[model samples]
Target: MRVAIVHDELMRKGGAEQVVLTMLKAFPNADLFTLAYNPEGTYPEYKNYKINTSKLQFLSRSVKWMQRLYFPLGVWAMKSLKVHGYDVVLISNTHSAKYVDIDNDALVFIYTYTPFRLAWEPTSYSQYVESRGVYRWVFDKVINYLREIDRKEAQKGDFYLGMTKETAQRIRDAYQVEDVTIIAPDVKTVNFKLSDKEKEYYLVVSRLEYYKKTDLAIEAFNELGLPLIVVGSGTKADELKRLAKPNIQFRSGLTSEELADLYANCKALIFPQYEDYGITPLEAIASGRPVIAYERGGVLETMIPYRGDASKATAVFFKEQTIESLKGAIELFQSLNFDPEFIKAHAEKFDEYVFIDKIKQFVTDKYRKSRQKSSPKPKLASEKRINS
Candidate 1:
């Protein structure tokens, strides 16, 4: 079968980007499509693939600038992409790449990270943008326009594959469509080969962005007066650091082994963000560290919370995305004793083997169904007689 892979863009090697990489590896012969590609910004391994990017890639100079143009020009550019030759198109995306024009007979399965957050959950997206001074009346009108188009495209999808059940429900609500299969992303469990030594400090692995609520984590840790180490860097780093107390530490550019060691040593993984499907928490769990996460999004599917049986729970949940909730969860985490064996085993459940197997099966099934759809169904003799 002629297969193709479509991603919204490649700017960073995040969990969503990792999914695209996996899909590309799954169909090595398939052509890779994107609105943009930045060799410097994302994984270097992506250069090995046969990539086809839109004209708009030139217009979207930087990763940050692409955010503003993605809705306006990226949507238009992707919508006009002529994906006529491919028999099966597996789109690993969160944004407007879903609206690409493909052969009517082709199986267009959207392995979605999310329905565009700006379209579906406008509040989180807007609050950040408005804070940056772009959320004027003109911007609201443009957003409304984008949301309308996005909703229309959502219904046009042949099938939807979500990373979590929570995302599936969100898609269902946003698109008013059903048949969203929950296929979670896998982590490279082997990379998290860590020692059994537990450390005093807790860990935070994130992009350091506003939506992530890293600032809130810093505030919580400050109030608790505990050692908190935040890994990774972004635009919000300076601001987050300002909010942080002496107990908080920021470290960037760690090697894979070093990251694993960090994960292994920390008391627990702190994930303040509500993500489509977070891989960092699972990686920490694979490293035999329990998670202290904001109890929403994909974490809900992965982390089994600590009840009376601490050995059974892979992680602890904070109810609200507030400093008080996080502080309370951290205090609770200090009291509990987690089994490393249980935590490691829990992470193994969504390993690369399982994820690849499921993707292969899903794509094969969808391809067969698509072919069947293209073939004509026969009418009964009575119906033929009536026609005559």
Candidate 2:
């Protein structure tokens, strides 16, 4: 059967993009569809795919602005796509793929990271505060309209797959849709290895963003006088660097191999945000380094409880995202003992092979059920002779 996999954009290789790649590998014959593809010196693995980008390629540089102005354009664009030939369509979305149009007979599966959180009351407050002027006013109205459309389109899909339980709960709350399945993001294990090197300092690996709470990690490290190494870059990089103390070092644009090295030797990984489903924490655990994460959101599901026993605990939890909470967790980490073997074993649960197998099973089962329902019944011999 022909399959088409759609994604928001192939601009960056984040957790969402990794999910798309895994899907493609599982369905090697499937064609990939996206709004834009900015090579941007990404992983060479992407170079081998059959990619079909939208007509918006000319406006690729300003796609972000365009999304704000023409919020429903993605849905409209999909109406023109020749997906009639495909039997199944899988959408790996963090944004607008829920708006895509597909044949009624086709099986459409959506992998939702979150259900348009920016349209909700308390969440939209944060979005509005981060915007300015007429653009802000215009976007607020546009997002509300899109939220309604998103809910309608969600109902058309045969299945909804969430990357985390937090996201699945949001889907239920926002769209009032049930029967959602949770499939956590997977980590690449080929390049990463368990090292015997002595741990030196703590590490934080994430895009520098306001919502990520990188500042909280900086503040905690500063107050505790601990050496902290930060990897990854984003809009808040310069601002975060300005506030960082001498002991906190900010390095951006490192390859996955380089990050694995840092994860292998770091004393512990510091995750300050309440993420949807963070991959960095899992990577650190795979490298045999324990995680010190805020005790909320997906972290609660991923991290093992730290009870001052090195042989038993794989991670420690901080109940708050504030500097004091992180500082307290760091102090506790210093006093506790952690086993590297136990940490690595916990990470193996989300390894690439397991993730790939799950996707294959989900898609195959969905397609089989769809075919059975659409199959025609056998005609009686007398009815068949009438045509003759």
Candidate 3:
């Protein structure tokens, strides 16, 4: 069977992009499709595949520019994609890629990170765009238009997959769809190993973005006067750096090995954001490190929260995303004793192999069911004759 994998765009190295790469591994012969591909911005491994892009690829190759154009032009670009000669089309979509046109007979499976957040969740989207007065008026118009389009596009999928229960609920609410299968994103557990080095500083492995709540970590670390190593870069990088005290240091563009080293030796990973399905916490846990995360979103499902059980806990939960809540969690973390082996073992549950197996099986079963429905059934021999 000819399989095709469609992603919104291959523009950056994030959790969604990583999932697309994993899908490619599962279907090695599958053709990869996207709206755009920026080689310098995305993972280098994608170069190994013959990535097919829409007309948008010719307009601009800038990752930042492409991201800015996502809402306005993404729907059109996604809809422009005409995927033919495929038995199954697996869409790894966080945005408009689910709109891709496929053969009517082809089984379309959408692995949604969440329904288009820009259209459905205005508060979260406001962080990325200027939303006040005239801008807000225009934003509202654009969002309303996109919401209709997003919902309509969502109906194209034969099956739906969500990374977490929270995201599944979001998908169901946004598209008014049912039965969203929960498939948690994976981490490369074997790639990370616990180091023998001293745990000297706290770690924050997230994009420096407003929605990510990286600022909360900076504020908390600044007040605590503890050493924090922020390992990411984004539009908020300069602003986050300025907000941070000398105790908080910023680093970016590190290799996997370099990141794993930091994860291994860090006091604990500080996750301030409410992610759809966070991968960093799992990565930190795989390095035999405990996480101090905001008690919300996918982390609640992934990390075993500390509720007076240090032996079973893999993380200390902060009730709020505020600085004080994070600081309190940090203090609680310092007093607690975590078993490194236990933490590592917990992370292994979300290993990449497991994710691959689940995805492959799901696709196989769905494809078989689709084929069975389409195939002609034998005619009944003893049917009642209608009066002429």
Give the number of the best model, judged by lDDT. 3
lDDT of 1 by residue, 268-379 (tens): 9999888878999999999989999888888888889888899999889989988889889998989999999888999999888788889988898878865666555544
The global Cα lDDT (0 to 1) of model 3 is: 0.86
Q: How much lDDT does each candidate structure score?
A: 0.81, 0.77, 0.86
lDDT of 2 by residue, 94-117 (tens): 666555556655677888887765
Error of 3 at 121 (Å): 1.0
lDDT of 1 at 304: 92
Q: Residue 130 error for model 1, in Å?
A: 3.8
Point out the higher-scoring one by lDDT: 1 or 3.
3
Off by over 4 Å in 3: 127-130, 374-388
Order of candidate numbers by TM-score, starting with the best: 3, 1, 2
Query: By TM-score, how accurate is candidate 1?
Result: 0.91
Model 3 Cα shift for residue 324 (angstroms):
1.1
Q: State the number of backbone clashes in model 2.
A: 1
| Per-residue lDDT of candidate 3, residues 1-388 (tens digit) | 7999999888777888888888887889999999999988888899899999988898758877787777657667778788889999999997767778777667789899988877887788535366678878888888899898777777777789999888999999998788899888888898899887889999999877778999899999889999999999888999998899999989998887898899999999999998888989999999999999988889989999998978798999999878889999999889998989999999999988899999999999988876777554533222211110
Q: Clashes in model 2: which pairs?
A: 310-337
Question: Against the true structure, whose TM-score is highest?
Answer: 3
Model 1: residues >4 Å from true position, as ranges? 126-135, 372-374, 377-388
